[model samples]
Target: MALAIFDLDNTLLAGDSDHAWLEFLSTLGIVDGEELRRANDRYYRDYMNGELDMGDFLRFVLAPMAAHPRRQLDAWHCQYMQERVLPMITDASRALVRKHADAGDTLLIITATNRFVTAPIAVELGVPTLLATEAECDDNGEFTGRSYGIPCFQEGKVERLRQWLGARGLPWEDSLSTAYFYSDSHNDLPLLELVGNPVAVDPDKILLATAQERGWPVLSLHGSCHPVT
Candidate 1:
């Protein structure tokens, strides 16, 4: 069966869930909210500029999970999903996902955002498989504020996907027949290139230029998700 993979932020959703999660937490007055916001904005700028320091950025993003209880964190995420993620999800994105599901393709979200922040959104999108960065935890099941393995950004995304497939005893060639990856950022170029169909969804200028040059299809999944084949 063909695989229909999606990038979480800016492709299916209208905004960045990682940044939004941090902003959502800020409203609760946790950990120097102003400074955290400034840093988060700076990192976002770096991401847009294609200069993301995945190592440092992940540490900052995951640190709070180490201190908070799992129960409280989950409750916060539920609220965050309702307040932040739900609005960002438009009718078009949902339609795109349903289109793939209807076609019987394996739907997955491959994002650099940590699983804790992006997992429920994957569920909200009705996608069953999510290949996202993982956070490590202590023996007691408390987060240790560290990444478990490779950071799922840039080339890391490709590696992680390969690893994911290998874990399922499936090889890359099997999925290459008609695999599709939908994304908006140049950061996703590695994985995008690996797929049979690399669709640019409301692309940033850099990816748009490359997509045009490469003759890849550019489509929008924002306003109203229509069937695109």
Candidate 2:
């Protein structure tokens, strides 16, 4: 069966869900409002410029919760997912996910966001598998803000997705003929190039330029239920 991989941030939703989650966390007293806001602004600039290092990025996002118990983080994530992320899902993205699900294709969400945050979104979307960054935990189950595996961003995304496919006995070459990938950032170039159908959804300038150069189809789901041609 064909596999359909989706980028979760701006591609699937109107904006970065991670940023929204952080904003929500700030309200919940789990994260410092000023610190998170400043860090997020810097993160966005670095990410857009392709200058974000995986380790640094992970630490920047998770460092605030290092002192908090893991249980509290889990609770905050669940509440954030239900109250903020779930309601922000766009109809166009949801319909696309449903289309792939109804066709029996393997629907996967590949994101740089930690699994703790992305898992609930994947479940809500009915996606079977999520390939995301794994944060390390202490013996007592407290977060260390360190990665147990490769951070799922830039080239790391391609590496992890390939590992996931290999473990499932799916060959990248064989699947390329029917595989589909949807993304919004230039950082996803490696994975996007591996698929036969590369779609740019609400692409940023870099992604838009890359798509144009590669002749990939560009799709816009903003403010509409149907994809703009």
Candidate 3:
């Protein structure tokens, strides 16, 4: 069976989870709503332009998790899932996932979003594997506001996936033969190029152009979800 890898933001989901999480926190008054939103918007713009500084963005996003207890963060995340994330999940996305499943392809969701925010969403999608940027933890099992290892973005996604495959005794070259990666951002081009089949789902402007030039399949999973930006 082939491997199907899906990007979390704007591909399988209708929107960016990292941005939504921060917005949820701002609305709860956990962080300064106006300030965080302005900064978030800036980072998001950078991301859309393919110029995001992952280091700075991670620090900004993870700081709030560092300040709060795990229990409290978990509670807020539950609410965030119900209010923010659930709506982003759409029937089209679910059907795409099922399409891969019915074909006996291994399902994986890999995203630049941190694991704390995405793990549950993976569960909701019924995808059994996830590769996400890991947030560091302290001795007390609390977040340290730092990322662990490499942030899974751009070229790093290729590295992270390679490492994951190596750990599972799947050789990098061998796995690529049957691998299919679906993404919407130009930033994912590195991994997309490495896979056997790369599908652009509701791709951004730059990615759409690249996909067209490369003769890659362009898909639209925005059937019932919010229109992909």
Per-residue C-alpha lDDT of model 1 across residues 74-156, encoded as one tens digit per residue = 99999999999999998788888888899899899999999999989999999999989999978888889999888889998
TM-score of 1: 0.94
lDDT (0-100) at residue 57 of candidate 3? 92
Candidate topping lDDT: 3
In terms of lDDT, the poorest run of 10 residues in model 2 is 220-229
Tens digit of per-residue lDDT, candidate 3, span 1-229 = 9999999999989899998998999898888988887997899899988899999999999999999999899999999999999999888888889988998999999999999999999999999999999999999889999999989999999999999999999989879877999999999999998899999999999999999999998888876333323
lDDT of each: 0.88, 0.84, 0.92
Q: In angstroms, what RMSD does candidate 2 have relative to the true structure?
A: 1.8
What's each prediction's TM-score? 0.94, 0.93, 0.95
Model 2: CA > 4 A from native: 225-229
Q: Among all windows of ten consecutive residues in candidate 1, which has the lowest summed lDDT?
A: 220-229
What shift in Å separates residue 194 of candidate 2 from its native position after superposition? 1.5
Residue range 84-110, candidate 2, lDDT tens digits = 887778788888898888888989999
lDDT of 2: 0.84
lDDT of 3 at 212: 98
